[model samples]
Target chain A: MYESNRKSSIVNIYLGSMKIAYVLPMTWACGGISAPLSQVNALSTRGHDITVFAPKDGRIDWFPLAAPVQVHCEHPVEEYFDAVVYVGDTFAQHPFSSAGQKFLLLQGKDHLWTAPAKRNELLQGYSDPQYHILVVSGWLADFVHGKCGNPRISIIGNGIDINRFFPAPAPREKFRLLLEGNFPDRNKNVIAAIEIAGRVRQHFPVEVWAMARRFTSAGELVDRVFLDPPSDEIPGIYQQCDALIKTSILEGFGLPHLEAMACGCIPITYASGGVMDFCKHGENSLIAGVGNLPSLLGHVLHFLSDSDLRSQLKDGALATAKLYPWNRVADALERAFAGGIEGKS
Target chain B: MRILAFTRESYPSNYPTSYILMHQSMALEELGHEVHYYQQDKHPLGLTDYLNSFSFDLIFLDLEFLRSNPLLRILSQYRRIEPIHIVGALYSLPAPPGPAWEVVDFTITPWKGETTSGLAAQFDLRYLPLAYSDRLHKRQSASAGSIFVGNTTGNKHKEAGVYLDELIGERSVFCIGPEFTEKYMDPFMLGSLYASSRCLPNFHYSWEKSGDCILNERFWQTARCGIPVNDYSPLMDEVFETGLLEHFCFADTRIWQNRIRNLNSGAETVHPALIQKLDDSLKEHSYKDRMKQLLDWLR
Candidate 1:
């Protein structure tokens, strides 16, 4: 009976030709914007009319309409969309106050214990059974459930484009390393990696390359550090790198780790946040204690001295990256839509 | 007048809130008031502790601590001796209760105007705008940007590092806070270096949460130094209406990109006219004057 009910609900959505709207905080080159765009691409292919309500930006590549995706600038929510996906924090007062199915694709907890007004808004939004909240990591999911009191939560890990990042030729005699993202981010912990590199230089010749909008003095220690003007040559950079060191203090999900892994770069990350979800401590990548300067330095030294260990981590990281393809994430999102339709009926 | 102020302990490396509170207490003392600051943890357990130290002309309670414990009920007993005032931004706590809400006399928040008005109504407490000490004013006039403070950790919402990254892209942005370790040193110092070359020096509070916009000393310091801050709050308009301080919507990368591009185009320099307008506005809404106005309501 449940299966039959689910089938009818999906049929109702299809027969009614329900339109889904995704409200994304349109930004350039950030994980929040890219993740949603990728999901939209995948979902649009599955025949759902997906309209992305985001801030207008010139940098983002416009999605093809043939794939059932439409990008609209954020505006009043007067027009009815079957499902509304909020990518980030919802404004205190939504202009188009409507009783529609709301989906929160939470990246992290921003105003969780502070910002009372925002918390209240999220509480109200979550209480509505029609709302389906999805968090990127288990820690964030637990936080949403504990703080927002929303029991109905899902964990949809972020995905990477495997084709963009593929294995490179064997590393040269000197180990080439790369780190990406907003460099100053405390969670990224690029400084720790640099410190570890300094210590590792005792053993092997190490060249660190950082690709970010900015770089720090420690990042300057690298052979080459590229700033904000992100190059299209990123794939080549990843391939050349022997390993990607992530020493972030905290993360909702480590996207760069996955990206680097996809490029066949060994990942050595501090064991915290969502890194544990993807990387097994010894299997896929080297997981060190967060802020353990000595251990991290030791791990870097180990990777530098032992080529066999680096090779193992590289292969494992590549294997782990395969499990989280964009297509699979898109399929999971489609399944969520199907579940939402089922509940409506 | 003896004033008993209750708040969190001063962790030297903590945000300006604790430092601001201490500085404000000292300023209040300069105005012929004896200020006694008490951390929530220092309060002795049981009824005897309260009866012994409940006498004061004015009692300033940090509402953040009161909400977590039954201290408000205990404090209500001494309402006659001390008129309780709750100060601090209301973090993640539930809406104030109806009957219990009357215990608080004044609610000092970082928010301004309507946001403050709305919050005051919700808690049934009188609202007072935040005050900046004279020390901060002195710091503001200093042209050199030697200190690069970034939020390396603690609060996630502030996204201070994110802003620093944009401002200090390829430039050095400095990270200063309790959470700063060797790990964050690379990105933090790099941001500092990048910002150092530019006219504006980059500094971030790596440990503290974002402050509400009430044109406090920090905002002035950033503006007076000709450093544009990528403020996330709407209250920034109320504080700096003349556009002296560059503001960017937190999630809007285009705004960041445009600002960077403008900076590259040599439009990054702060105009004297804009600085004059900001200074003039701040003088008009001086903390002392605002405090006097609030004190009048109490009278």
Candidate 2:
């Protein structure tokens, strides 16, 4: 979910990797877990001793980590970490403030929260201005430090693996559309994507696929519903589809766009939130009018009809995906960590 | 002769200079010379009061950076009468032989080329090859694998990477650096690491590979620990011209593996007579002997 951010290089004689602790909300299946995992994997490989505290659930066995993130489940992690990054609500809920230079990571504000006071309370905690505040996108950073009046903030954008996802070598479904993310989430608007696919299917020889932990294809107008898919299965899914649909009401940073782009899947969305940072209309992706159902369906049909536009959009999407590798994100995080240590944050 | 050894206060575990100072002081002490160590920026004693405690004949200064003029100011206090000062530099040369060397009578250097050449022509230069410390003693005991020791992250470790690439996870190589091992190993454990190791691989912190490169003091520590060294430099062959170098120094990784396997299988043991010859040669590079040579050069 990271958007536009970062670059700085620090060289010194002391070259030991600092011990780090990543505080995650849960080790359970969540779309948000992917963002932190990308950075965790990158930092761990760079030789930092990474201890991941996913206390509420079982050890995260799905994501590939360079070194096994010592999951603190049975007991508390005793070793002193140089930095402990509490992702989103984990900072408020967890008890690791006295451990090290505490950092609060906000992926992006979720629209699901209706209670205005509670949302302000969470933002107030993130904007304490004492410790470092890391956001996923430029827009979220602006919203936090600008609108919310938080003095300390650093933009560490989300990353997608460029090598893992690529243009469909031999696309299994030529005109098929795939919707990624949990179906039950109201913000994701899975029903809208499913209905749009049904409208396209009426005229064109096209099928719709929905990927989630648990979603039924029977009544949902989708041809297939991939349930709790393995990590390897993701790239293949992205490659097979001609387009990936994101009908989210609000997003901190749209991770699916880059992910889909990497797989050469052209993203069709109503340019909103962090999506605006990457998705340029008629450039990297096709942007439809926000809340305008006609423009959204027209863009989907436009992709289905035109071969030249799809190829051009695919190339642009592929190029956009390469810009945000995990390595770059990790470097920016390291700089933020350094700045926090020096009290510059 | 009464010698006042001055070095900036440093923990032996943190700084290599402090570690080297231990041996350098021991060498002077071993020669029946009185060596009193005074750590600058460490003690409460004033510079004049520190010098007043003893009538020093010569003062040994380990030149890291000439920041505080503690000694210079002390010498200036007794401008009419002052002991000669000898300064030693390693890793980096005190470039341009700057104004820092103005007060220094003699300068000791490690290698022969550009690292010392410019300064040698500028000052009274003495060659003190990196040596085995007085605290270390040879042990026949050894462990299972080849090992390396250094600060892992900050070091220019291209050779270690190359060595790892060549070994390809085949050889049981123990990497003892800041991350892998304790921050720093004590002399006893460090010696045991050398004693127990079969193939002792090391790299120069300096990447000037083709030039006249002398390795870190750890290079001598491994030799003193009584293990065969796998230094990837021609300097070893040039220095240990004794035919025993052929038996000990290995150039290729495949050949090193073949020999290590032979030693492991009891087909061959590192020749004790060769070890004796090397041990006899070690004295020449020993701090005591190097100090003796320096004194002889002065005479």
Candidate 3:
């Protein structure tokens, strides 16, 4: 079984745990904030002394964490951390003084910055000699290398909680397609999924289902749209749907697709570079080129016609999900931390 | 040659005209030519001032931006001062009569219709079809299916009845129209989409079907992807190998239905000769090829 193999793999890479502190971003019900929180939970389970530093007003209420969250507004934390990993671009802006190996986790590109100067500032921080650059995907590694001219970078992929997300035993009455992510985000490309749904509806009696933080005019197109469902209820939503249509053009590490795969929901996705970290086209999931809505529609149609393919891909999805337990992600992070310690010596 | 190219579409747009500007500019640059891209809306300097700043050998203007009075005045002024060649691309057909045409030296049009060519003959218009960027639109190894990738918002889908859902009934026809998002697909993404599908069901506007040799960019784009383009255009006979286009060409909704069924059933397979011809056609129809021809004409 892959679950046992995944656990063994994690055990094999078990370096002695040390005091690891993760600097958090302002919290929202998004993956950017959740990925680190989930990783911190996994690391604590591995017997690491973990302390989460958060902005004073930042709400860490999206999910429960195993580690104690230290709220630092303007005040500096006087505690010593063995390895402090700074998340997001503002690591330079809010310098937390700590006696430890520092890492700037470059999760995504400077997407919020419209100006070239802001982008250059972010690139400068990536190339900073003090912090070891760690990224979530191979795309980011290439980005930092190409832009920042920093060759030495570690890529630790995001993880899925196999226990939290799993396939349901019962099947739905009607064939349904699940769409994820918020509508306002341009990078998410939610419109592409809606258009594909509109096209697919012409062929079969299918329903469009979506779960998002909020809804816009496009939300009306979905047959059943749930606004910000609890994290525990996400698995049920994924289980009911046959496929998850992810149309994001840019993603550091698209966790929802992975989470959907864990629930035996075949990820019919665009080849948004981050999803490539897990998804193999025609293997575990169907991947088309980003913005290629027709090819993505083709995938959905293929699922409808070919029952054998559906079964095969469902099996492949489950098998792929088993390989990425949170323990493995924790192991990768620990290895990255160990490498930093060895380099210092 | 130092050429000044005019574009109206913003970067990262879904507009076909934007792609034309980008592909042509890229081709011209690759051909060891200096191309200064100028957008009238975005440029800080005025049109006349921008023209004065750069010593351009030629000014390639998209015909839509050809303002009648002011543009003619600027061109007229430049003509007296310097021998600057003014070539304009008529992206859309039925070239309107204007005073701007008086100062224009040559006109380039992608349309091959009687109206377009007749106007071209009347005003020395060249019958140059739109080309695909080989740098972007090339086939990669992938699992294939029948697909249609173009804007459905236009009259083409409406007049031909290709826009209806029944056309895609029970078959794996991938339909992607970015018009829903008010954006155009990225060129690299479009190339990958072309490569993903085994064949593309290309439809043209109803007006384009009437003895008009309006071979849209999809013909070359999908062909460059090394896939069979099941086009509804009768103009394919004038461009591609005869027997080849007959196999891929659909005349009506009934024929389109049969072709789709055949393709889905795996009864229809693109022949080796068809693929070889497609590969050969791509060599002559790339943006670089078009740019080379344009430059040769200037010489």
Candidate 4:
């Protein structure tokens, strides 16, 4: 009788642990989806047993799990997970009827211009009152709420690891400007940056460092372009740069902007999409109008000529970075889950 | 009658085949037919059991699966029991002989015209037109610019990279396919090239291989954004009217360049009308209605 009671107690304790299932499309590689990996890491640390349900061959870290939880391949299976967080639109049609709580974390709507059928499924499927939608930016949240009619949507800005990206002492001599993106195709507005850099170089000694895997020869217009060598050195590059510029046509959330700011580098970015949610013009980062070469160049020049402005922006950026620490973000996520689960109950 | 539609399972990355099957199944259910989905991984259908189970009124099988599986032989065994609808990229590919002769009742090919009759003779097929879900219809009504859809890599024979590189330089081109692999291709570079234009090209394609058909969804959504599509397949014309899409035929450099120029310049083109005609023909014989008709014929 005592043995049976002990076994029952152990089973109850095992069952009591909150089982959270995360469904991410791909692994971290500097795209919009990569921004959430830090949060996933933070959430895992909080004792909320987490299992990431993703593609069998995806590069996501599965070793962090305490014990082997059910990581079912490519199918919706009934599990004891208390919450399911889907990181992309691929799981938009996934049946959440079995899960305790369903949440969608959208980084960006990549195929929004196309794939109406999939978008409709996502919008309709998530419209269920039981599901909670969390977007990285207000634009994304508003779009989802308005299009899908889901009232429980929340805008949870992406959090960065402040420790990984905290400010380094300003480098002496030639001002270093870093531009990093996984895909630095025409849209990183790399060409425009190059053009602006060229204009700025005539006045000041400017050196541009680009961290990207796929850099077209066409982008050779820039003087000092560096291709991404490996993943480990990304933090070092961020630490070395004086300012980071993100001129993408649109971003779900600019992680590099936050990462650069965390490292105490001044951020010069376009005022668009999720960047506006955090980057206030002249406060934390210099905001330039999208695709405006003159304005983008103007921001770059202001930081280059005025050391005091750069110093102020650096301080402001590092200060702002504190607000979006991974710990705080994880706590907010836990709160969201608690509120959602409690409300549903 | 109860029907079971099967495809690959859902994942975080969007797979186009899964999307297509979901829409088709939903459409079938909406037409007052019972539909159940048996995914590849969830509950894999073995040949004998799949043939024996519940006696479905109809079964729609993706051609890619037929190529990959030995189930086609089992399908041939029960060719007389009920209607089997074969859907997917069926352009001169080797499939099981028995199923080709007797198992497949009707075939839905992405390619158009008497191409159906040829496929029928070889695989005992009947041509069926493609149809989009109501979701696509709504997206089309709201679209603003041209949405170009195609993979960076061409199918087994064609080279999509060559055409894609040239096309990327000129117009706003968004890519939807598998994730960017170093060995395979980079989807992000493709996306950035497309998003470079004033129009914020959204990259919403799933890198997941769940087998959902995102092509149709992308077509309608692109249309919703008022983005005319510069697609590679002739099949798109059949599913969406010429009024809905801007079609492009793949060819060598010079021909492709001319077509791109004509499309960009908004010149009078026969391609648009041809697509519209194809759409009109398909509208008259919708895939859902046709599938029902074929099943009834078998009954």
Cα lDDT computed for each candidate against the true fold:
0.56, 0.67, 0.73, 0.55
Off by over 4 Å in 3: A1-15, A57-62, A110-118, B1-299
Query: Which residue window of length 10 is worst by lDDT in model 2 chain B?
Result: B88-97
Q: DockQ for every model, please.
A: 0.01, 0.00, 0.05, 0.01
Q: How far in Å is the alpha carbon of B171 misplaced in model 1? A: 49
> Pick by lDDT: which candidate is best?
3
- DockQ agreement of candidate 4 with the native complex: 0.01
Q: Across residues B210-262, which tens digit of lDDT does each residue of candidate 4 receive?
A: 22222333433333333233333445544555444434323244555555455
List TM-scores for all candidates, in order. Answer: 0.49, 0.50, 0.60, 0.49
Order of the predicted models by TM-score, top scorer first? 3, 2, 1, 4
Best candidate (score: TM-score): 3
Candidate 1 DockQ, CA atoms: 0.01
lDDT digits (tens) for residues B240-288 of candidate 3: 7776667767667667666765765678877777777767756778889
Error of 4 at A277 (Å): 1.9
Candidate 2 lDDT over residue span B153-199, tens digit each = 43335655655544435655566666553454654356656787765
Worst 10 residues of 4 chain A by lDDT: A1-10
Error of 2 at A11 (Å): 4.3
- Give the alpha carbon lDDT tens digit for every residue of A70-124 in model 1: 4443556777777778877653334345635667787754443336787567667
Residues B138-256, candidate 1, lDDT per residue (tens digit)? 21332333334433334233555555545445443434554444232232122223234333332223222233334344454344334444434455566556354454223254565
Ranking by lDDT: 3, 2, 1, 4
lDDT (C-alpha) at residue A175 in model 3: 78
**Better candidate by lDDT, 1 or 3:** 3
Ranking by DockQ: 3, 1, 4, 2
Model 1 residue A243 distance off true place after TM-score fit, in angstroms = 1.1
